[model samples]
Target: MDKKIVFITGVSRGIGLEIAKCFSNNGYFVLGTSRSDFDLAKVLSSDECLHIQLNVTDRNQISACLDQLKEIDKVPNVLINNAGITKDQLFLRMKNEDWDDVIETNLTSVFNMSKLFIKSMVKERSGSIINISSVAGLMGNAGQVNYSASKAGLGGFTRALAKEVAARNITVNCIAPGFIETDMTDHFQDKDLENILNQIPANKMGNPQHIADLALFLASSKGNYITGQTISVDGGLFMS
Candidate 1:
C-alpha cells in the first residue's frame, strides 16, 4: 500500500514541526513548509520528509508549493493549516497593517489552501483538513483582538466548509490549542504565566506533541466519522 501524504504549513519549528515528525514517524510522507531559510539537512534529514521554504501569506508561494507536491505525484491526503501569527495589542492601538497581516496569514491563507486542495480530495473522495486555531479564539483575550478574530474566523470556516465537503467524504476540523509551551509563549512573564497556569484545570502547559497526537488521530481512519467540529487540546482551559 502507498503511504499517506501530509502537507503541513509553518513547519520550521514549534507545534507544526512536531506534527510533521509525528506523521513521518508513523510512515506518512510528510511535506513541510516554512518561510525561514531552514537548513533542511539539519532539521529533517529524512527521505520521508520534504522541507520547502514557503510563506503562507504569499498566494504565489502557496500555489508554487502545491505545484511542487503535484510534481512528485503525491497529492496530500491531509492538509494541516497550521501557519499563524499574533500581533498582540489593544484594539484601539492596533495598526491597520497589523490587523490585515494577521487576517491574511492566519485566516485568509486557510481559505486559499483549502480551496486549492479540496478539488483533489473531492475527486478522490477521501481526505482530512485539520486547522490549528487557539483558545484565545474561543474565550477571547485582551491585547489580542486581531489574533482572536482571525482564530474565531477559523472556527466558522471549519464548520461551514465541513458541510460543503462532507458529501464528498472530506472532513474538516479545527484544533483550538490553549497555552502550549513554544517559542511564541516564552515571552510571558513568570507571574503572568503562573496565573494562566492556575486557570487551566490541568495546571500545566500543553506540549506540542500533545497537539500533534490529536492531529494524527483526526487524520487517521479512526476520525472518519468526525467532521465540522472544533476540538480543544488545551489541558482543560476551556470546557465546551
Candidate 2:
C-alpha cells in the first residue's frame, strides 16, 4: 500500500462521493463512510477502497470503524469531516431536536472523528483535517440557524485545532461551499434555484466535482503550508 490513505465521511453520494472518486483516481486509498448503506466499490474502480456504514454522530459506531481500520493496519493520512445534514426551518419554528442533531452531526462529529484519527497523525508527524462547512455558516441563512451555527463552530474548531497541531506538522482547515448541485438542493424548484443562482455572481450552481478538486489539492503536498484557513468555493456568493 504505497498510496496514501484518505478517510472521507458521507460518501454515499454528492460531494463526499465525488471526493472519494477524485482521491482514488489520483492513486489514494479511500476509507469512506455514510449514514446510509452505500457501495463505493461499485462506483470506484479502485481495489483500495473501503466503505463503512457509519453515523458520524455516534461514538460507538465510529469506534467500530476504528476497529475495522486497525484490522487492516491502515491509518488515514487525511481526514475529511464531510458528513452533515440540514433540517431547514425558520428560527421561530425550529425544533430542539433539529438543533441538537445538526450540532452533533455537523460540528461534534468533527470533534469525534478528528480526535480518533489525530493521535496517529501526531505520532507520524503528518496529517490534514478538512472540515466541510457552508456559506450559511459565514453569511447566515434565513431558515437554517442550527445548520449555520454548526458549520460556523467548525470554522472556529478548525482554526484552533490547526494552531494546536501545527507544531506536530498536522494541518486543519475548513472549506465553506456555497450552493452546490447535490441532493441537499434537489428539493429546490426551478424558481427557487433561480433565486439562488441570481445571488451567485457567477450565476450558476457548482458541481460536486468542483469541491472534490479542491479537496484533492488541500490534501496534497501543494497544500502543505496552508492551515487554519476557511476557503470558500461559492462562486463569489459570500466573499470574506
- Indicate which candidate wins on lDDT: 2
TM-score of each: 0.96, 0.97
**Superposed Cα deviation of residue 101, candidate 2 (Å):** 0.7
Measured on C-alpha atoms, candidate 2 has an lDDT of 0.91
Top model by TM-score, which number? 2
| lDDT score of residue 234 within candidate 2 | 95
RMSD of candidate 2 to true structure, Å: 1.3
- Which residue pairs collide in model 2, if any? none
Off by over 4 Å in 2: 1-3
Candidate 1 CA-lDDT value? 0.89
Which lDDT tens digits does candidate 1 get at residues 80-120? 99999989899899999999999999999999888878999
